[model samples]
Target: MPATRPPTPLRTPRRRPKKSRSRRPRPPRPPPPPPSESPAVDPENCPVATDAEGGVDNAILLPDDPWTLNASSLTLKDASYKGIVEVRTASGATKRVLKYVISGGTDIGDLHQTVQDKRSGATHHVQAAKGSLSTITDGDTVMYTESISGNLLGLIPITFDPEHPPPLDIPLIYFTKVTVKQAGQFGGTLHVPGLRQYITT
Candidate 1:
């Protein structure tokens, strides 16, 4: 009988260790540029006035002109202030003033200034068919329109019902509206430093 030969054990192969990878350091990035600043405004040019009695036909409103805005609706940029609409009137021995802060960005809208009688303390809202819709700004945007009486015409804010109202589907019809407080009218002044010019649409 031949003796059984022992089977030789299979040898397992050994794996070599992986080499460590080295990464290069990256350079630092540069900072971004600073924001632009608005042009300096002269206080003398601020609070631009539009007088019906005065010979001045129109007062130009500019962003560079510095004017104080008590209230603002939109976000201000370039160190610019908000915008406002003010009307003053003197009838007999009485005087009155009304102010409305401009809001809702640079969309042309109607701003109605309630006219009042200084003598009787009675208020009146002028209704007219023809009026100039001036663009009002305060270094922010052309957001509103003010009705100012011209040489041969009177510009007054047109009113509408916010609840049950007509369709403002007309191309030129304004959807935004603002009603100012009561203001007496006796050959007074309307100071709109933000009033640039008449809006085409």
Candidate 2:
């Protein structure tokens, strides 16, 4: 019987394949974008509007710096904050006020307030001997005006916290305008972004 090739030699079955030992590769993800930068605070580029009362009206920022006061970038007059006053009434209530001077920074400067000649429409000058601020006022408050040494103009820092919400000491600043009224018309306006904006971050 044709040597039936020696009885088929016994052979081991191939080992069972490991159940899909490998997995499908994953998809790649997209990279993140760069952070956005805020534009510099400028009347032209940023939000600058006048209030019904006029004077740098209010250079306010919203959504961002919802509490921001002053135009940190206000360089129009180049005045510096001078001092603060805390007012306590007979009712055990208190208030914080800020003072700004037209001149007398580092060395000595000529601080003048400018107002317009209502009838003549000519620019008038009122020297600012000094400046001061009363932090909380539901509306604009022009206080303690005095003549500038030798000028006829009346001077004082006109300030307001429209909302007037407060800690009193650190009230929510709204807008500030330093005025040098020659008589009726406005002479010039100064920037008062409040203490927070004035300070370096």
Candidate 3:
């Protein structure tokens, strides 16, 4: 072989590495929405009285009679205070009076003061025992009667204008129901009469 003087060093060709098509990155997923504050109330699982859309009636229940009560003249005996609250209708065709007795370990004077304060638009937080008896009249004659019982502290009666006449005969209904599920949460459903169904999940 003819001595080819040392062959010039061959130049290695540079090649770019292949991109990884098999390991493509995935797009990120969107975040979920926040939970609702007020849940819907299912009608089938709630009371009939709560069938109303808003779960309560907007109309105020005013007495049909006009009468006044003097807490000063009332007697607080046996840890209970007894008094009368009167109402009069605009047409003078109806009159209603509600007799109530609030009893508990607390003093009746304190209860009276509390009630008076509420009537005067004063706010005080105290728990007490309370009950009421509702009596209605048509043209100055007693027509209907009903009893009221509940947490005394939660019962706040708002007086109606003497020029406005409330319903002559209003229906009174009391209902209580409880349901327990295996789920790890508490929920409530209310079907208010003449209103929308409400559910809390």
TM-score top scorer = 2
Q: List ranges where model 3 is wrong by over 4 Å.
A: 1-4, 22-31, 34-79, 82-201
Q: Candidate 1 — which residues are off by over 4 angstroms?
A: 1-79, 82-108, 127-133, 136-175, 181-201
Which has the greatest lDDT? 1
Residue-wise C-alpha lDDT for candidate 3, range 28-92, written one tens digit per residue: 88788888688688877676463243332212333332212212112212221122223333333
lDDT per residue (tens digit) for residues 151-193 in model 1 = 1111333532222222332222223223322221111123333
lDDT of 2: 0.29
TM-score of each: 0.19, 0.21, 0.20
For candidate 1, what is the lDDT?
0.31
For residues 120-172, what per-residue lDDT tens digits would candidate 2 score against the true structure?
A: 65554433234423122122222211211221111323332222211232221
Candidate models: Cα lDDT each: 0.31, 0.29, 0.27
Position 104, candidate 2: lDDT: 16
Which ten contiguous residues of candidate 2 have the minimum total lDDT? Answer: 64-73
Global CA lDDT computed for model 3: 0.27
